[model samples]
Target: MVIADLFKKTEITVKNIELGEVETLNELTPEQLQLIEKGLQTVGFELLDDKRKQIVQKIKTIIIEIVQNQSKILQKINPSVYIAESIGRDYKYLTTLFSEVEGTTIEQFFIHQKIEKVKELLVYDEYTLSQIADMMYYSSVQHLSMQFKKITGLTPSHFKELKANKRISINQL
Candidate 1:
Protein backbone atom coordinates (compact mmCIF):
# COMPACT_ATOMS: atom_id res chain seq x y z
CA MET A 1 0.00 0.00 0.00
CA VAL A 2 3.01 2.29 0.43
CA ILE A 3 3.43 2.28 -3.33
CA ALA A 4 -0.24 3.03 -3.90
CA ASP A 5 -0.04 5.83 -1.36
CA LEU A 6 3.05 7.23 -3.02
CA PHE A 7 1.28 7.39 -6.37
CA LYS A 8 -1.81 8.78 -4.71
CA LYS A 9 0.27 11.61 -3.23
CA THR A 10 1.43 12.36 -6.73
CA GLU A 11 -2.20 12.48 -7.93
CA ILE A 12 -1.48 9.44 -10.07
CA THR A 13 -4.18 6.85 -10.36
CA VAL A 14 -2.88 3.44 -9.40
CA LYS A 15 -5.11 0.83 -10.96
CA ASN A 16 -3.27 -2.11 -9.46
CA ILE A 17 -0.26 -2.88 -7.29
CA GLU A 18 0.72 -6.46 -7.75
CA LEU A 19 4.37 -7.48 -7.79
CA GLY A 20 6.09 -6.02 -10.85
CA GLU A 21 2.87 -4.33 -11.93
CA VAL A 22 1.90 -0.69 -11.57
CA GLU A 23 -0.79 0.63 -13.88
CA THR A 24 -1.36 4.34 -14.38
CA LEU A 25 -4.19 5.92 -16.37
CA ASN A 26 -1.99 8.53 -18.05
CA GLU A 27 1.56 8.78 -19.28
CA LEU A 28 3.88 10.24 -16.66
CA THR A 29 6.18 13.12 -17.46
CA PRO A 30 9.94 12.58 -17.11
CA GLU A 31 9.93 14.67 -13.96
CA GLN A 32 6.99 12.78 -12.57
CA LEU A 33 8.67 9.52 -13.41
CA GLN A 34 11.85 10.63 -11.70
CA LEU A 35 9.98 11.69 -8.60
CA ILE A 36 8.10 8.39 -8.51
CA GLU A 37 11.23 6.39 -9.07
CA LYS A 38 12.97 8.27 -6.30
CA GLY A 39 10.07 7.62 -4.00
CA LEU A 40 10.11 3.92 -4.84
CA GLN A 41 13.82 3.66 -4.27
CA THR A 42 13.42 5.29 -0.91
CA VAL A 43 11.08 2.48 0.04
CA GLY A 44 13.30 -0.36 -1.28
CA PHE A 45 11.38 -0.78 -4.52
CA GLU A 46 13.31 -0.17 -7.71
CA LEU A 47 11.71 0.79 -11.00
CA LEU A 48 13.32 -1.80 -13.23
CA ASP A 49 14.16 -0.21 -16.60
CA ASP A 50 16.72 -2.72 -17.84
CA LYS A 51 15.34 -5.52 -19.98
CA ARG A 52 17.36 -8.20 -18.17
CA LYS A 53 16.31 -6.96 -14.75
CA GLN A 54 12.68 -6.83 -15.85
CA ILE A 55 12.80 -10.43 -17.05
CA VAL A 56 14.38 -11.57 -13.79
CA GLN A 57 11.78 -9.70 -11.75
CA LYS A 58 9.01 -11.26 -13.83
CA ILE A 59 10.41 -14.72 -13.22
CA LYS A 60 10.49 -14.15 -9.46
CA THR A 61 6.96 -12.73 -9.49
CA ILE A 62 5.56 -15.68 -11.45
CA ILE A 63 7.27 -18.22 -9.21
CA ILE A 64 6.07 -16.55 -6.02
CA GLU A 65 2.53 -16.19 -7.36
CA ILE A 66 2.34 -19.83 -8.40
CA VAL A 67 3.68 -21.23 -5.16
CA GLN A 68 1.83 -18.87 -2.81
CA ASN A 69 -1.47 -19.48 -4.59
CA GLN A 70 -0.92 -23.25 -4.61
CA SER A 71 -1.49 -23.09 -8.33
CA LYS A 72 -2.74 -26.32 -9.91
CA ILE A 73 -1.05 -25.40 -13.17
CA LEU A 74 2.21 -26.64 -11.68
CA GLN A 75 0.67 -30.09 -11.34
CA LYS A 76 -0.05 -30.11 -15.07
CA ILE A 77 3.12 -28.38 -16.23
CA ASN A 78 6.82 -28.27 -15.53
CA PRO A 79 7.99 -25.08 -13.82
CA SER A 80 10.71 -24.52 -16.40
CA VAL A 81 8.24 -24.62 -19.25
CA TYR A 82 5.77 -22.48 -17.36
CA ILE A 83 8.36 -19.79 -16.66
CA ALA A 84 9.70 -19.91 -20.21
CA GLU A 85 6.21 -19.54 -21.66
CA SER A 86 5.24 -16.85 -19.18
CA ILE A 87 8.33 -14.79 -19.90
CA GLY A 88 8.62 -15.67 -23.61
CA ARG A 89 12.20 -16.73 -23.04
CA ASP A 90 14.03 -20.03 -23.26
CA TYR A 91 14.32 -21.92 -19.98
CA LYS A 92 18.05 -22.42 -20.35
CA TYR A 93 18.68 -18.75 -20.92
CA LEU A 94 16.43 -17.71 -18.05
CA THR A 95 18.09 -20.16 -15.70
CA THR A 96 21.55 -18.96 -16.67
CA LEU A 97 20.61 -15.35 -16.21
CA PHE A 98 18.87 -15.97 -12.90
CA SER A 99 21.86 -17.83 -11.54
CA GLU A 100 24.22 -15.13 -12.67
CA VAL A 101 22.19 -12.32 -11.17
CA GLU A 102 20.67 -13.95 -8.08
CA GLY A 103 23.60 -16.18 -7.17
CA THR A 104 21.21 -19.08 -6.87
CA THR A 105 19.69 -21.50 -9.34
CA ILE A 106 16.03 -21.04 -10.24
CA GLU A 107 15.29 -24.56 -9.04
CA GLN A 108 16.77 -23.78 -5.63
CA PHE A 109 14.67 -20.64 -5.35
CA PHE A 110 11.55 -22.58 -6.30
CA ILE A 111 12.31 -25.23 -3.72
CA HIS A 112 12.86 -22.59 -1.04
CA GLN A 113 9.54 -20.97 -1.89
CA LYS A 114 7.75 -24.32 -1.75
CA ILE A 115 9.30 -25.13 1.58
CA GLU A 116 8.18 -21.78 2.93
CA LYS A 117 4.62 -22.50 1.76
CA VAL A 118 4.76 -25.83 3.49
CA LYS A 119 5.91 -24.10 6.64
CA GLU A 120 2.94 -21.75 6.39
CA LEU A 121 0.46 -24.59 5.96
CA LEU A 122 2.02 -26.45 8.86
CA VAL A 123 1.74 -23.42 11.08
CA TYR A 124 -1.91 -22.91 10.14
CA ASP A 125 -2.66 -26.46 11.39
CA GLU A 126 -5.50 -26.67 8.92
CA TYR A 127 -4.29 -29.63 6.89
CA THR A 128 -2.67 -33.01 7.23
CA LEU A 129 0.78 -33.79 5.88
CA SER A 130 -0.75 -35.85 3.09
CA GLN A 131 -3.07 -33.03 2.12
CA ILE A 132 -0.28 -30.48 2.19
CA ALA A 133 1.91 -32.75 0.08
CA ASP A 134 -0.82 -33.03 -2.49
CA MET A 135 -1.63 -29.33 -2.38
CA MET A 136 2.04 -28.49 -2.89
CA TYR A 137 2.34 -30.99 -5.77
CA TYR A 138 4.77 -33.24 -3.96
CA SER A 139 4.66 -36.79 -5.18
CA SER A 140 4.01 -38.11 -1.71
CA VAL A 141 4.11 -37.28 1.97
CA GLN A 142 7.51 -38.91 2.29
CA HIS A 143 8.91 -36.67 -0.40
CA LEU A 144 7.59 -33.60 1.34
CA SER A 145 8.93 -34.79 4.68
CA MET A 146 12.35 -35.44 3.20
CA GLN A 147 12.53 -32.07 1.55
CA PHE A 148 11.21 -30.36 4.63
CA LYS A 149 13.94 -31.99 6.65
CA LYS A 150 16.63 -31.23 4.12
CA ILE A 151 15.85 -27.56 3.91
CA THR A 152 15.02 -26.83 7.53
CA GLY A 153 16.84 -29.58 9.45
CA LEU A 154 13.49 -30.38 11.05
CA THR A 155 10.78 -32.77 10.02
CA PRO A 156 7.39 -31.30 9.27
CA SER A 157 5.84 -32.85 12.33
CA HIS A 158 8.65 -31.64 14.54
CA PHE A 159 8.49 -28.20 13.04
CA LYS A 160 4.79 -28.06 13.73
CA GLU A 161 5.30 -29.05 17.35
CA LEU A 162 7.71 -26.24 18.05
CA LYS A 163 6.54 -23.52 20.44
CA ALA A 164 7.69 -20.86 18.03
CA ASN A 165 6.37 -20.98 14.49
CA LYS A 166 9.29 -21.89 12.25
CA ARG A 167 7.96 -20.20 9.17
CA ILE A 168 9.94 -17.72 7.14
CA SER A 169 8.53 -14.81 5.23
CA ILE A 170 8.01 -15.59 1.55
CA ASN A 171 10.14 -12.64 0.55
CA GLN A 172 12.92 -13.75 2.88
CA LEU A 173 12.89 -17.22 1.37
Candidate 2:
Protein backbone atom coordinates (compact mmCIF):
# COMPACT_ATOMS: atom_id res chain seq x y z
CA MET A 1 0.00 0.00 0.00
CA VAL A 2 2.98 2.32 -0.37
CA ILE A 3 1.36 3.98 -3.35
CA ALA A 4 -1.97 4.35 -1.61
CA ASP A 5 -0.24 5.78 1.44
CA LEU A 6 1.65 8.24 -0.72
CA PHE A 7 -1.56 9.47 -2.32
CA LYS A 8 -3.32 9.61 1.05
CA LYS A 9 -0.48 11.65 2.49
CA THR A 10 -1.04 14.14 -0.33
CA GLU A 11 -4.78 14.33 0.57
CA ILE A 12 -5.78 12.43 -2.55
CA THR A 13 -8.41 9.74 -2.17
CA VAL A 14 -7.52 6.52 -3.90
CA LYS A 15 -10.77 5.11 -5.24
CA ASN A 16 -9.34 1.99 -6.73
CA ILE A 17 -6.12 0.01 -6.78
CA GLU A 18 -5.44 -2.04 -9.89
CA LEU A 19 -2.10 -3.24 -11.18
CA GLY A 20 -1.20 -0.12 -13.13
CA GLU A 21 -3.91 2.18 -11.93
CA VAL A 22 -4.75 4.22 -8.86
CA GLU A 23 -8.04 5.90 -9.45
CA THR A 24 -8.76 8.96 -7.38
CA LEU A 25 -12.03 10.54 -6.34
CA ASN A 26 -11.04 13.87 -7.83
CA GLU A 27 -8.48 15.29 -10.18
CA LEU A 28 -5.09 16.00 -8.67
CA THR A 29 -3.44 19.38 -9.03
CA PRO A 30 -0.03 19.62 -10.62
CA GLU A 31 1.61 20.17 -7.21
CA GLN A 32 -0.21 17.23 -5.62
CA LEU A 33 0.67 15.00 -8.53
CA GLN A 34 4.30 16.03 -8.29
CA LEU A 35 4.49 15.27 -4.62
CA ILE A 36 2.87 11.88 -5.03
CA GLU A 37 5.08 11.03 -7.98
CA LYS A 38 8.17 11.97 -6.00
CA GLY A 39 7.06 9.80 -3.12
CA LEU A 40 6.54 6.89 -5.48
CA GLN A 41 9.98 7.36 -7.03
CA THR A 42 11.54 7.20 -3.60
CA VAL A 43 10.10 3.73 -3.18
CA GLY A 44 11.17 2.54 -6.67
CA PHE A 45 7.60 2.90 -7.97
CA GLU A 46 6.70 5.15 -10.85
CA LEU A 47 3.62 7.16 -11.62
CA LEU A 48 2.71 5.92 -15.10
CA ASP A 49 0.84 8.94 -16.36
CA ASP A 50 1.45 7.88 -19.93
CA LYS A 51 -1.47 5.89 -21.21
CA ARG A 52 0.67 3.55 -23.31
CA LYS A 53 2.98 2.78 -20.40
CA GLN A 54 0.03 2.16 -18.16
CA ILE A 55 -1.37 -0.37 -20.60
CA VAL A 56 1.97 -2.14 -20.73
CA GLN A 57 2.13 -2.31 -16.97
CA LYS A 58 -1.40 -3.68 -16.86
CA ILE A 59 -0.42 -6.42 -19.28
CA LYS A 60 2.58 -7.32 -17.16
CA THR A 61 0.51 -7.38 -14.01
CA ILE A 62 -2.10 -9.71 -15.48
CA ILE A 63 0.52 -12.17 -16.69
CA ILE A 64 2.28 -12.06 -13.34
CA GLU A 65 -0.91 -12.67 -11.42
CA ILE A 66 -1.83 -15.60 -13.63
CA VAL A 67 1.56 -17.24 -13.47
CA GLN A 68 2.42 -16.48 -9.88
CA ASN A 69 -0.91 -16.44 -8.10
CA GLN A 70 -3.86 -17.74 -10.08
CA SER A 71 -2.51 -20.98 -11.44
CA LYS A 72 -5.94 -22.60 -11.67
CA ILE A 73 -7.41 -19.64 -13.49
CA LEU A 74 -4.45 -19.57 -15.83
CA GLN A 75 -5.03 -23.20 -16.69
CA LYS A 76 -8.62 -22.41 -17.51
CA ILE A 77 -8.06 -19.47 -19.81
CA ASN A 78 -5.83 -18.32 -22.65
CA PRO A 79 -3.64 -15.43 -21.56
CA SER A 80 -4.12 -13.40 -24.75
CA VAL A 81 -7.87 -13.56 -24.44
CA TYR A 82 -7.78 -12.94 -20.73
CA ILE A 83 -5.61 -9.89 -21.13
CA ALA A 84 -7.76 -8.51 -23.91
CA GLU A 85 -10.94 -9.09 -21.94
CA SER A 86 -9.48 -7.67 -18.74
CA ILE A 87 -8.24 -4.46 -20.36
CA GLY A 88 -11.02 -4.05 -22.93
CA ARG A 89 -8.44 -3.72 -25.71
CA ASP A 90 -7.58 -5.69 -28.79
CA TYR A 91 -4.88 -8.29 -28.24
CA LYS A 92 -3.00 -7.28 -31.40
CA TYR A 93 -2.60 -3.69 -30.25
CA LEU A 94 -1.56 -4.76 -26.81
CA THR A 95 0.99 -7.24 -28.18
CA THR A 96 2.45 -4.72 -30.65
CA LEU A 97 2.69 -1.99 -28.04
CA PHE A 98 4.21 -4.33 -25.50
CA SER A 99 6.83 -5.49 -28.00
CA GLU A 100 7.69 -1.93 -29.02
CA VAL A 101 8.12 -0.77 -25.44
CA GLU A 102 9.57 -3.88 -23.76
CA GLY A 103 11.62 -5.38 -26.63
CA THR A 104 10.06 -8.78 -25.99
CA THR A 105 6.87 -10.50 -27.04
CA ILE A 106 4.18 -10.97 -24.41
CA GLU A 107 4.42 -14.73 -24.88
CA GLN A 108 8.14 -14.69 -24.22
CA PHE A 109 7.69 -12.67 -21.07
CA PHE A 110 5.03 -15.08 -19.89
CA ILE A 111 7.33 -18.03 -20.48
CA HIS A 112 10.12 -16.34 -18.53
CA GLN A 113 7.79 -15.72 -15.63
CA LYS A 114 6.60 -19.32 -15.71
CA ILE A 115 10.15 -20.62 -15.74
CA GLU A 116 10.98 -18.39 -12.83
CA LYS A 117 8.07 -19.89 -10.95
CA VAL A 118 9.33 -23.35 -11.81
CA LYS A 119 12.72 -22.40 -10.43
CA GLU A 120 11.11 -21.29 -7.20
CA LEU A 121 9.15 -24.53 -6.87
CA LEU A 122 12.29 -26.49 -7.60
CA VAL A 123 14.18 -24.66 -4.91
CA TYR A 124 11.42 -25.19 -2.41
CA ASP A 125 11.94 -28.96 -2.67
CA GLU A 126 8.39 -29.55 -1.58
CA TYR A 127 7.09 -30.84 -4.91
CA THR A 128 8.18 -33.42 -7.39
CA LEU A 129 8.98 -32.40 -10.95
CA SER A 130 5.74 -33.95 -12.13
CA GLN A 131 3.74 -32.11 -9.53
CA ILE A 132 5.43 -28.86 -10.36
CA ALA A 133 4.71 -29.41 -14.02
CA ASP A 134 1.04 -30.07 -13.29
CA MET A 135 0.82 -27.05 -11.04
CA MET A 136 2.38 -24.87 -13.74
CA TYR A 137 -0.07 -26.12 -16.39
CA TYR A 138 2.45 -28.05 -18.36
CA SER A 139 1.19 -30.93 -20.44
CA SER A 140 3.67 -33.31 -18.87
CA VAL A 141 6.89 -33.39 -16.94
CA GLN A 142 8.87 -33.88 -20.17
CA HIS A 143 7.29 -30.82 -21.69
CA LEU A 144 8.07 -28.81 -18.61
CA SER A 145 11.65 -30.03 -18.60
CA MET A 146 12.12 -29.15 -22.24
CA GLN A 147 10.81 -25.63 -21.84
CA PHE A 148 12.70 -25.10 -18.60
CA LYS A 149 15.92 -26.18 -20.24
CA LYS A 150 15.26 -24.00 -23.26
CA ILE A 151 14.68 -20.90 -21.17
CA THR A 152 17.19 -21.39 -18.36
CA GLY A 153 19.94 -23.32 -20.22
CA LEU A 154 19.72 -25.88 -17.43
CA THR A 155 17.37 -28.68 -16.65
CA PRO A 156 15.07 -28.34 -13.67
CA SER A 157 16.93 -31.14 -11.96
CA HIS A 158 20.22 -29.39 -12.46
CA PHE A 159 18.83 -26.10 -11.26
CA LYS A 160 17.63 -27.69 -8.05
CA GLU A 161 20.92 -29.50 -7.58
CA LEU A 162 22.88 -26.29 -7.92
CA LYS A 163 20.80 -24.73 -5.16
CA ALA A 164 21.90 -21.28 -6.32
CA ASN A 165 19.71 -18.22 -6.01
CA LYS A 166 18.91 -18.25 -9.71
CA ARG A 167 15.35 -17.06 -9.46
CA ILE A 168 14.68 -13.63 -10.89
CA SER A 169 12.48 -11.06 -9.24
CA ILE A 170 9.06 -10.83 -10.91
CA ASN A 171 9.54 -7.11 -11.54
CA GLN A 172 12.75 -7.82 -13.43
CA LEU A 173 11.09 -10.48 -15.56
Clashing pairs in 1: none
Alpha-carbon lDDT, every model: 0.91, 0.89
RMSD of 1: 6.1
lDDT of 2 by residue, 6-117 (tens): 8778888888986567888889899988998899899998888989888999999989989888367766788899999999999999999999999999999999999999
Most accurate candidate by lDDT: 1
Candidate 2 Cα RMSD (Å): 6.0
Clashes per prediction? 0, 0
Q: How does residue 63 of candidate 1 score in lDDT? A: 94
Candidate 1 has its poorest 10 consecutive residues by lDDT at 163-172
Clashes of 2: 0
